[model samples]
Target chain A: MSIKSIAFIGLGAMGAPMAENLVKRQFRVTGFDMRQEARQALVNAGGHAADSAKAAATGADALVLMVVNAAQARSVLFEAGALEALAPSASVFLMATCPPGEAEAIAAAVEKTGRHLVDAPVSGGIAGARGATLTIMVGATQESFALARPVLDAMGDKVFHVGFKPGQGATVKTVNQLLCGVHIAAAAEALSLAEKAGIDGALLFEIMGGSAASSWMLKDRGPRMLLDDAPIASAVDIFVKDLGIVLDAGRSAKTALPLAAAAHQMFLASSGLGHGARDDSQVVRAYRALNAKPANDP
Target chain B: MSIKSIAFIGLGAMGAPMAENLVKRQFRVTGFDMRQEARQALVNAGGHAADSAKAAATGADALVLMVVNAAQARSVLFEAGALEALAPSASVFLMATCPPGEAEAIAAAVEKTGRHLVDAPVSGGIAGARGATLTIMVGATQESFALARPVLDAMGDKVFHVGFKPGQGATVKTVNQLLCGVHIAAAAEALSLAEKAGIDGALLFEIMGGSAASSWMLKDRGPRMLLDDAPIASAVDIFVKDLGIVLDAGRSAKTALPLAAAAHQMFLASSGLGHGARDDSQVVRAYRALNAKPANDP
Candidate 1:
């Protein structure tokens, strides 16, 4: 179960830094992405850049999928023939958030190819990825977990072996997203209420940051929410996508998620108002717009 | 300007301890409540028991109103003639969560009677009240704030002069409730999702508690939510009341509070399901009930 080489797919904001961390840790890393600049960034970090996913996987002991969703993971592994390109018994780590059933399905497919699959979805955004301080929730068999431990450690400080089944990692991640999305929207609503009430938003943020109402998202995104034009750390549409997965999972489990559903609608409204690519804190803008409407209009 | 005696109204879970703290600090405290037991408790704590709100206010330099809402505060101050009973130039501390406009109206009435109104609303629940560690947000003129500072310090550890306006403390408190109510409901949704996903709820709590998904409410109320019959520290009906005030303030300001509105509905559903008097964590029960419905129904 000795890991020698790794192939990393999807070098986006999160993935590029994660792949960079592994390379800095002296792993022989081959990275691939649709974007030329993303591939070039990895090469600049002293990691090899592959022309295609298959080429990246070739001769690698493990293939890491940091792609956007399950569909992209499927495209990389099956459509791009990355699965066949990997060495025998190679471990595949799915770090991106996806539906539990989708991860399980991908695991089943990877298992059919005589490879191990570790459903290891991660938290702690782009900054965490670069710092190698992400929290990785792993769902895999003991053998697969053993094979992926070093690789997981290289990318995250907190690597939790959540369960011994495929999709369990995704399950934990879905729960995290449910709380994250709701907290962000709630933060926006509180700030918006403060602004509308003519209270100082910054002062309110400071007060609540020390109060029982505090949340990681409230403290993290609250100041950004005050800025009318904050940088896009996480886009509003990410929640639109992540909360969609959450509701889908809730549907599959017959679990109703009213708060998540409500938060999802606010995110959707933000995206609908052309803030999809803006910072998620820009959900406050959507609130501002809603408040700007006449009292009896609704 | 020197404070000598105090009258405290509403000796409930929060008020009784706050009054006890003041009495323990050697303030001549006369407390009154509709319940005889509440008055008896105050009497046992070395504080005088008044037969009525007016009797409590008589000869007192400051009157502390910790009643449930604005209506009750008005009942004690106006209907019960407590304001008239108080000494001239006395200060009235409105320490309950009330509508901003109501506080303004009350402040005007107190001003007409040559009494100062300090709109000082406190956070940190019952335990904080007992421990004298509450955070009090004060809305008062400089003169009135000066008069009430020592009195406020006797009950709360952190007292912020948020603004000079009569309703500003209520405004800050409203924003706090918006976040608190939403966070509590979001915590319930995340825990419920974990329970439905077959993941260990306690483990998820631990993981998320340390992650970016962490929140004060989640860390505080989440363990209680896991219990089938958790103690009623804060009732579901309290959120029902607080969030109602939140939406009321939003309506007054023409502000749209989708998250707060949504959280309010969930609290209402929890109450409608006969958990109104149950602990606020029982909002999870509403989620459980929703999840228990047949899959095809929704």
Candidate 2:
């Protein structure tokens, strides 16, 4: 199958860059997003901008779903009729992080319409998406994976064929988020302890960054956590959603995830305290609020 | 200030090798521990084995305390009179993870006895201790740090003078433990999630080890977590103690450490389940037990 034209939905921070990469790689990309600015960004990157998911997916050999969650993926594919709009036998790549059960169900539905569903979820954050260095975990039948390989490669540097099962990619991605969400919250908690102890946060970062306690999240998010007012990179609400997906998956699998559950609470507190739109590093604010003392006492 | 003699207390997994490193470096070393085997291990490494902490400290230029906790340090220094046994102006290195307040109190008492305290807490685990590659975070006056530099260099490949205060090393160590403990529990939780989801635990380890969710603890402990019965490298009780020290420090500073508290509970549960003596990686067992069902049901 000679696949060329691609439809990309959800032109957000991660998806926009990924769609841009497809355009740069000379794939005929048609992108759509709810946000006009996001759609405009895609148009600026030399991709055609469609008004809706269905319009973007129409006549395309492949449709990529990079929306926020399973609900959005469902709405776009079913409610918005993107699945029905895609050409018969067109591969649908679900790049969003969703529950494995949800992915399997969606795959079954797509299969009934004579289309292939490639359960491909990605990691490596926004910079990776922009640079086309994202890691993609793909779950699909051999034929579907073969049809989606070039498109996956165009958006990600490392592609792992995790399994032929539909939800395997979501399972792997859930595992990834389980760690990522916990690590981010853990970093926030540690830095909060450092601040409360009056230890120099930057110095502690340098020391721990070189020590056995270090994680990719601590090294990547540690500096942002130190800022008096950090810029929003990834918002706290994202983990609120991601970890929710993680816990749901665990619940579905009859697994108890205490650490992930605790981390979800941390993110929830951050969101509750009005930091949902702020950088996830601001989860430290939740800790600070909890530990707040009389200003004059110290 | 030609520091030729060293007194090392607490010859456990970390201390015995540290003392051995000093001996290998041609320093005159005397080591002591409650365990006969530990003391014999030091003796086998060509270091003098002493009957007590006082015996170890007597006439030494520096005394290194590698005991389990602040209580042990207090017992060795006050109850056992190791402070009175050391020579005047002798530098004492507190190499164990302890509460900062405890270290400050010990430093004050050591100063009253005309001895110096260098709060030098070490990391890099058993392999680092044996290979002389431990990272030592030191808190001391310039004179005391200068006095202990040669001795510190003999035992650790990387040494950072963290601050001038006595408890700064403990503060830095608390920060380290907060991350280390939480990361270990996080790795266990993620691996358990994978196990329950029927994903290959080893494959998930490889994939996540290379992803953004990766950490030193995850990479170091992840493989061990997958084992049916992993060897004891660092025991669960160790984190129980370290994170307890961390939470104690947090309490003293009036900080809220939800993640650390959650991880502490995981370790405590692991210990409560009789895996305290097992490797810390066995914390996954705590997760497994929680998620366990009738074997044939799944």
Candidate 3:
């Protein structure tokens, strides 16, 4: 019941910063990753690096999975035998963005191993994760959320218990991605149109963002779009996966996700044009190529 | 150069309230409309009512056109004889939502008569119009914008001089509408997906709006989407026209507008379903019909 030791899996761009925050907050943290450099990075940051996922889970009060998808989260636990290696009373918090149904299924699998599962999905990007201000959406039993509150509080500024069902967090995250995908595409189109019309894209952004046209996507992605190439913060295929989950969830609900579907195609086109591994803002590259006008040129 | 007399044409929901605001501000306002009741409503509000657009334009230093589209705006000015009646140095502010190219054409026609044209588009819905806090996007030469600044100040709190050309206002407005169209559809899809998953739609709105999924559309349209019969504010076909302009601009620029195109279909379907006159948020109804769970139903 006491939160002392924790295992953080998947030390990538987001995960590494999140794990560092936990260690900074005085938690006994052990990190594990397949990448030797990632493990070394954690070891250099005053935290122990586990030899394996199961080794990290051993004697830990909580195991946090910050992997890419459900497949990796599953492999880290079930396939790697971390479920059997962790303390019987420990909790596993899956913070990866995955399909809602998969989260539910995984929760069932984790519960059968005599441990608690908190389907927690974090938002606000790596910046918020490192700042410990990320918004965490939780879908778990009230008891599980209560037990995980202290640890989650150390990582996120705001935590909402959206529902008692295990998959609801992922469900909300999917919906979030749908909006993000559509808004990003919408912003890119607007900027391109303005630029084509010989209007200043940056000035147009300032005017539109102050108007009813303003969106989180426009505000977040608009400036990044002004740069043709930045480091890949979040990839185009990330939306390809997230919006794919959105469309799939919509299909299951028999709901029509027209904008999300359309945005999905744009990301697909970006991926098709060999920018899949680049930042999601690179979706603008697809439009830029099609329009044949460099945004910075005119 | 005295600014005592003003004429307002095309007294629709927005125009009527706008003219009334001018009257309330103690301006010598004359309102004209094809709809008798629209004019009568202005008269009822203590403003002078003119029988024809030309009569209203005669002797006025400023004329504001709040008509539907470019063709209608042209017809009122030329065919309806308003242009022939205006004073030589008068300023005509076209406050309607029209395309940039059309605005440019209209500006050319207005300037041919030695009159100035201010391409000013207002935002903030009927409530904002009534409250006199609408945001006005104005595009004009320095003299024209200066001539209309006080008038725009009387109508809106935020007056942005987007550019020096008449079409630039329309261009900026089109950009705003593109994001507006995409965000509304995105909000609908996100909310519907959450509702379909047995998650509380209201709670989902609260969570997503507070999270990275947040946007002006989600805040503006999310609650109205929950109403059984959404009150008509802005109709669905409005987005149809707006997105049409957006996509048309994009296509003319050879820019891809996938999100706008997708959002366009939802509005088109809403229009086709006989909900064109309903609130734009009623696009959620399209998702409802597909899901067989009405948005208003808890």
Candidate 4:
């Protein structure tokens, strides 16, 4: 039930906080990342730093990959020899938002190495990551889920077993991102209309938040959309990647996702407008450019 | 503050229940509609029945228009001579999902007749309407809002005064519909993909509904989507009207609403498939036809 030695990879904003939570919960955590500062933050939180993912995974009972996308998750666990380095019975939790197909492939590759693979993608933003209240959706054998329970508990408050397929977690996560991305863009569009109509955006937020139009994305991204400019937590490129996964998944299944496609285009337009690195709420900037002003100029 | 005498127009699913609520709450409600059965149902609920909207509005303290669209609202209040029949200080609570422009024009027309107007579009679906727990969004002057508050209390649990602008309530309602329309379509698309991927549709619904993809629309529409068929509470034609209003509003404002437009297209596709009068969740039927069944459809 205890994670004696765990390896965490890609300690970025989300991963760093999650890895720290694991360490703070008294797990002997070994973290690896190309970003020295990210790894250093995990190290400062009582986790050990490793030079490579393989080094971190060697002798660890569990390996958690929190990389940016499927490519990174694959590169670290499969390509970089980390899967081979892990103990035969070690459980691997892939928490990155990636293509479902890729998750399925990676899970198969890990399973081939005689290790348990937990397709665990999480929600709840940076704040949740640090506060250890994230929601983790798992698509794995019940055995693997049970094995990874302690580590998951250290990282999230809610852990659900979605299905028996490795890609189910990624599939559900893509759906979440599809809704989140579309809702955020929709919020921008509606708020822009309000602002163009001379209604105060703040008051609109207050009213809508309490109304049926309310969603997690609106409550989270609406205020940030009002900020003229702000620091980025989740960047625009994340949606570009996430929504691309959604569209690709839709296309693969021959299922048309018009709203997701439209949302994809806005994030594309936002990225195309050179705000890709900015906060995802910067998608509002696309709306601002299309409509005149969503807020009075400071 | 008491609503002793009132008229309720458009005795359809929502309007009939709402009219009954007024009667249940001790208001002397006069119900009007072209449908004899609809009027009879209201009369059975102890409300007076009138053959015309003007007949209902005449000498009443307030007239609540719960019609289908702006055209019906316009025909009743303007074209049908209801405005001329209502008392000078009588209030008109326009509680239908119509275009913001229509709401604004109606408000102005009512105000010129020395009548108070409250743009009070509602949410909570048919169930909410019947249960008297609908959420009402009001856009009226302080005096008008205060005047309509008692009647609103009879119909809804929450009444939000969005702004003093006549169209503000419709604008906010349109925003709510925008999210609902897009979220429902997105839920359909996602659930369709999950089904195509060989996952159980009901299980996927249970999983995603418990996860971050959860939204008011998704949770509300998801179960119905799983059924090959279900009763039509709201229909695809409804979204066709609502999302049409959304896209038109966005286009007139020159605001880019790519998500709403895309969601609108899905509803159009469903309508084209001849399921316009079926449940709006039947949008998934379009996906079902286009997508190949999972390998293990047993």
Candidate 5:
């Protein structure tokens, strides 16, 4: 059956606009958040406001968990009775960035209830979320993928069915984070080395951004890296968390990710240096801190 | 005085075409190489071929050293008497990817002899050399830059006067190599983790090549990484050597480049595993060897 209603939990910056986009597509979108303003913002955007996750999922064709973490998703579904409230044989789209192992466990539990689970995770950050241009990676059975396609189309233009395994989409996302985090940290390392030799950071990036040294992260975050304080586009703690997930994925799969592991250390150091809340580009600060010369040196 | 007669050393894969490009631009070009065919290739393209470095440099306004390393450049300029053979107050464009410290030393020695040394290193590889589209990073005084401008423009379209100090251009090139090496190895690590989870490597790179995960190295070397044997665009030992230079530069400046140091190990292992002559993308093999599941484990 087609999805006419979507129960979207976690009405934060990403979820609110995503739920609103579903509502604009003529689907009945009921969104639930602990914050009244968040729920009200979705309501103002023509989505229904729900006081609880269970209320939002009642009779909905699909339930999308966009909450903060796997534990929160679990609380909403099992503890809050959202799973039981969904219509019989309805699909659950877990769109949060969860560990692959956790996603697999969640899938088995969801499948036990005679419902389908679409393992979906996203990239593209706030602007992509607001503009409905997010890149969504899905891991689901062919049946669930068909069921989720039209609804997923409402929120993202770039959607890929990565694999049929329940945790494969999460794996793709974990890998994506691995590349992004490593690239950002590597850019910091490169820029820091150049600055140590007194080459202008701006000029170095201007040359690198057009050369084989370029990365999406370098072109996007490189200018901000030159600044003493760049406004937060994304916090350093996000990569601290994301690369943590990447390492966890590697461990579970018994893979050694030396580059990712080293990159994560820089993010962890940046966070420990109290720049966790600062922009991700501030990871360069960690490099600077580690490599700065002694005051007494010539 | 304007540069007219030019001496080009090391007429190998990159230098042969570079000398030919200078010939096409109407410079009175004379090139020398150890190999007869390399020198003949330049001669066939309308440039003259000299039997020795000193013979090529005799009375030339500019000497372009595109040799393999600092040792070879030193041999050609000092031991081979090319420095003394140059016209009065001539300029030397050292275009090898040498360590920044070595470039500085070479410049000092050249300056002591009443000649200018422009520390110029290039990227874009053999293809860039042939098309004269190389990105040349130069570190020279204003007078040296003015003298080298028209002559350098004949070989590379993107010529950057990175700094006045002789080693700064080499520093930028060192940092550029740092980013490039880390990016290639990071792509391997990311792809290996995805494959460990049974996700498709091509699909993973396709998603990543569009997302923030993308790098010039990933987009260029990623596809070749999936194949069992990819025809060599660049050998793995190239990075093995380049990242070595990067680390040497970092060490000289007292900077701790953890990411670059980690990436160098992977390239080193790939070379140690007897894939040194293989394509650089085969750094993935080091990752594969590290992370492969047991053959006997069912």
Candidate 6:
């Protein structure tokens, strides 16, 4: 309850708004990002800006990593000396999506340095981030969760404590991405087939959006899939990475995830098709390519 | 809308209630089914009982074939003389989930007999049927749709005129089944991986049901998945049959539906494992079997 000072690393699309939310909640947020513009944006929004992750973490009550993945999270905490720089027993909230095994390993190393680690991965994308309505899944001991709760709540409305084990949150996130990735691809697959049959893609989605077939991804991503181009919310490479983490989690658990594995292929194909940086909804392009007619069948 | 009387065939789970909804709305509904009890149940609900499908359609204003599939629909209209039994130019509402090609064939045969054909397929299952909340998708000429609208609306709150051609509605329904099937199987694949990692299935779904990973199927079917003996809302065999129609539509369109095809195998496996008639959520058993650890691994 006494936590006040916080370190926020990686001020990209998701992290910047999250740090701004913390600053609005009266936390002494010191945000760090390699981009000078990103760092300056935080200071302009009434928070401190650090030149490096270690400098950001100096004696902070908590460290929030919104880095791209576990490797960057690791470089911030260990390679960049952020974990050692935090105050004793300061909670290190790893909010990056990560593989379960990597999360567990990072937790072990952080705990070895006398700091608590809270594996908290989030979804709801950039819009969720800016609105402070992201769903955060936490896997940490009760004490660690308690220490991280107020800071966590400032950035997200729905914060679920999934388990007491370090890697559990990441596993839940891995599963989440598995469902999300598959549902998007499935929507694309469904819509593609409907289009092939001469059904209007937009109307088909409107009907399916209200039916039992509806998914959050379908409603949110379905329209974008119909577009020739859409503003990027999250890129195809993001799922390429997340679903890669998902399959890695499956491998670590010795579990078979046939749908996730198949969905991962579509994202991979999309990235290979050179839309890796396009909106993830562009995964439909892969479907269109796969099911495109013989070009002269008529 | 002078379609004052209707012949409702196949008074099974979904059909029986749809017929009753029509009767409630003051349509004189004559019903037929193989089961005497099915026919008697319709009479108890203030509808008439017919000895056969042809008898039900005798001079009726509309003939609604809510039969098992296109084959049964063909049998009722063609083999049982129900098409000829109807008054000339009466609308024939084929409100069954069928392959698009098959729906088109039936439409051609009906149009040749001077009866208007509405390729109207529905989603929302038995509960939707009972509540008159089924989502009905129609692909018919505007004239045919206008004639069929009143009775379709009596049975469904959301009656969509999807197209001006027969079979487009069935194609939409096929796509709906594709999403629903993959989502159900994907939910199983996701939760199975979570369970393998020692995460609570109930808790995982609770987290996911509120996140972007959510689907109508995940929310509706997820809780039942955690139970050892949940009541059947819809059975595994139903999805097996429906997804089969989806793949058939895809094949006929020369579309490659990898996800739908993969989801079908799981349902087939569940049926092959003797859980076909069980709640569709029991498809998780297939995931469990596929990922079960060796006895000596732990």
Each candidate's clash count: 0, 0, 0, 0, 0, 0
Report, for every candidate in turn, its global Cα lDDT versus the true structure. 0.90, 0.88, 0.86, 0.84, 0.92, 0.91
Candidate 1 deviant stretches above 4 angstroms: A23-26, A34-47, A293-298, B24-26, B34-47, B293-298
Candidate 6: misplaced stretches above 4 Å? A293-298, B293-298
List per-model TM-scores for chain B: 0.93, 0.90, 0.91, 0.92, 0.97, 0.95
In model 4, pairs of residues that clash are none
Considering the two chains of model 2, state its CAPRI-style docking category.
medium
DockQ of each: 0.71, 0.70, 0.62, 0.45, 0.89, 0.82
- 1 against 2, candidate with superior TM-score: 1
TM-score of 4: 0.86
How would you encode candidate 1's per-residue C-alpha lDDT over A98-175 as one tens digit per residue? 998899999999999899999999999877898999999999999899889989999999998888888999999999
lDDT of 3 by residue, B1-298 (tens): 7566789998887888899988987888899998899989999998999999999999788899998888889998999999889888998989999988889999999998899999998888888788898888888999999888888888898898888899988988888898888888888878778887777878888877887678888898988899889887788988988999988877666777777887888888889888999899989878777666655645
CAPRI docking class of candidate 6: high
The weakest ten consecutive residues by lDDT in model 6 chain A span A289-298
Ranked by lDDT from best down, the candidates are 5, 6, 1, 2, 3, 4
Tens digit of lDDT per residue, candidate 1, span B85-126?
A: 999999999998998889999999999988899999999988
How do the residues B1-298 of candidate 4 rate in per-residue lDDT, one tens digit apiece? Answer: 4457998898998999999999988999999989999999998989899888889989899999998888888889888998788877999989988888889989998998888999999988788888998888788999999888889999998788878878888888888788778878878888877776666677666666665566667777889997767788789999988999988778766677777887888889889989999999998877766675766664
Tell me the tens digit of each residue's lDDT in model 5 across B1-298. Answer: 8999999999888998899999999999999989999988888899899999999999999999999999999999999999999998999999999999999999999999899999999998889999999999999999999989998899999999999999999999999899999999999998888878778889999999989999999999999999998999999999999999999998889999999999999999999999999999999999998998556532
- Residue B284 of candidate 2: its Cα lDDT? 85
Best by TM-score: 5
Residue A14 lDDT (model 6): 93
Best by DockQ: 5
What proportion of true contacts does candidate 3 retain?
A: 0.79
- Show pairs that collide, candidate 5: none
RMSD of 1: 3.3
The residue-by-residue lDDT of candidate 2 on A158-275, one tens digit each, is 8988888889889999999999989988888887776665567788888889998899998988899878789887899988998999999988898888889988998999899998
